[model samples]
Target: MATYNLNDIVLGVDIGGSHITAAIINLKEKKEIKSTWNRNLINAKGTSHQILQGWASTILQSMESVETKPEKIRIAMPGPMDYETGICLIQDQDKFRSLYSLNIKELLAAEIGYDPADISFHNDAACFLKGELYGGSLYGFDKAIGLTLGTGLGTSYTSSGKAEDADLWNMGFLEGIAEDYISTRWFVKRFYELTGKQVADVKELIDNHAGSTDFYQVFSEFSNNLASFIYQFIQRETPLAAVIGGNIAHADTYFMKETQQELNELLGYSFPVKKSFLGESAILLGAGAST
Candidate 1:
């Protein structure tokens, strides 16, 4: 099949546990194209099955207002999915348990009145890498990795201007991979147990008290673990640099700089750490780029 052309209007959806964010992308522009969204989040609130109906209805309705049928509708969902099979391949229930039991592509296409051939699927972090490379911060970088240190550690690797599935989640990265140590859930749980304080968000912890005893410990430990993997990657794939994104990269003072510093200290090599060029719309934009 011929890839969707630069002139086509592709719709991208960033399906998170909290909300389904959507965008209408004109590939010809390659920058910020038209986009909008609905704010109702169901699955994160334990209404996992309901999210399918909610998203299908909301996305199709929203697409109508764009005045474009979108030659392609590309979606970014949680990891462990089979892109070839066009089905979610879930291994755990941290989120999207209902999707774990559904053939998401068929269900979505049947309900949305679109042919399966008109859609594309990618893990969310892989989508992030595509967005970053094709439209965001790493626009000119030849090779890079996009690491999303969000609720879990979302990771993607890119080379030669294309994206790939490298879901390093809990895969024993360094000591034990992402999600095992350095995620918001993990940090916040450690914070609650260590400080006995009811923190609102994990960013708040890094923002307000990064210098504190607890965050200092976790931050360094996480950085060190990340560095070991970076050093090994240097010995193996050796990409030019790595771009860190998602909610955690906002704490550049905590992880981004430190991650790079550790890379240098541990490996005697230097590489820049870039923040995601696109903001909240990155994953959707990237998914659109993939389509």
Candidate 2:
């Protein structure tokens, strides 16, 4: 690990469908400055200006956590986005519709009084994997896959210190698309289909009924489904390991063992499937790594 001077740190931010988080990371150290971490809920349904202001406010809060100002920043955000141009092309995706076709870097910079050129962007999934590869579980591996198991299946790959989006969420899968079976919506939908109860999300189901056999069965099926998905990706990519992150990872204790079991049985070996130890900070660390 390398040591970094305070002036070499950069602000790192993660933008989600419903929230935003920011922190500062020492590029040379490849470590997040814990004191600089901050997060805030954002209403993605708000108008463009409102959303911008909310993001700006949260970003300011994170910046305030540090003494010296950040002169450069990097953001990990979802797409359809033009990372190079810092434009958001997201549309009809149930979040941030107000930002469709807007240049997020320019918009956010204008709101926060920073030069747009000082900011850069990368795919959120890519950033997550990059963080892991740089400082988390995948640090020793040259080739690996990462999945952010949340509202959607965020996929990414890393090889030789470079990370990129897998873009496999929409690919064809069992009876529909990959995300149909691999995301939080799948858990909610499958649970509802099985029990006729409309729970908010998998977290809600786990929190309310984790001890129940019904929800346990749901997690079993989810583990099987995820294992199958990983099998396919592994066969194609041959990654040394698969690292998982996102909100659903909070329930890894309940489902990950079975997932690992299924993968081991299918592959005839113990293929590592590890949950992100860094959790939410992974993206911030990753955004900084990318910077």
Candidate 3:
């Protein structure tokens, strides 16, 4: 290992079910190198080679935007993956099936130009919470929880400034698991049941029907469902604050207030519920926090 300046750069990659975003970061400054953020859509259902190609292409583009090569690369990868060993087990998840049991670190390093030892991995959900704990909404809190409400539900908890996976997405809820009511599929299903029209995602519905009664009703139900889930989590974990992220959180204005109100009534007091300030780059920064 060689010593470097505090401002030395590292590459951070945030991989999701649909895309991979790569950025160059100045670790000490906690900021991304200007113009170095690059992203590419990945076909989650594609073959292993195609998926790896997408990651390599986007990462190379990000690397090209900077003048110097990075000493390390930290990846925020989605599960089920082995973060410590770098094995990818994304089986039966409708994505990355071909890469099941693959050693991602070795594969990615072979696909790109980095030593396997120079790369590290963390769970995407855990990184999300870690980012908030490191520099985003959960700063200064001794304990916190994070939720990512996207294609699926992601939960994590942090205490003493370190984050870990909570894995509460499958915890028992109403008719099924918490994820059944709190995920993208749930929103789409509920919205279709309410309006008899189908929309691709939560953003589409929010964008197309901002002021409609049905839209408001749909979001109201969403807020309640989310609040109920949060109540369960809070009672169990007892964190100081809860930070919500992911694509559905992009429409915070539509459901946040109601969720807060519901929590207030349920808890008999106000609890801090924050929107993710770092947006898409949170997990990227979190993945590189240890660098």
Best by TM-score: 2
Better model by TM-score, 1 or 3?
A: 3
**How many backbone clashes can be found in candidate 3?**
0
| lDDT (10s digit) by residue, model 2, range 169-231 | 877988999888888878888888888888977778977877877898899998998999999
State how far residue 204 of model 1 sits from its true place (Å): 4.6
For each candidate, how many residue pairs have backbone atoms clashing (under 3 Å)? 1, 0, 0
By summed lDDT, the worst window of 10 consecutive residues in model 3 runs over 1-10
Across 170-227, the per-residue lDDT of candidate 3 in tens digits comes to 7899998888899888888988898899987787887787798888888899899999
**Candidate 3 runs further than 4 Å off:** 1-7
In angstroms, give how far residue 67 of model 3 lies from its true place: 2.8
How does each model score on lDDT?
A: 0.71, 0.86, 0.85
Q: Per-residue lDDT tens digits of candidate 1, residues 1-291?
A: 123343667777877656677767666776434444543554554554576787787678556655546767888877777875677766473667667656778778888999888877888888888888876788888788777777667777875667875767766654445576767776777678878876655668866776788878777776776676666655655678777777777766766667778888887767766788786677877887774
How many steric overlaps does candidate 1 have?
A: 1
Worst 10 residues of 1 by lDDT: 31-40
Model 2 score (lDDT): 0.86
**Candidate 1: where is the Cα deviation over 4 Å?**
1-7, 35-42, 45-48, 198-200, 204-212
Q: Work out the TM-score per prediction.
A: 0.85, 0.93, 0.92
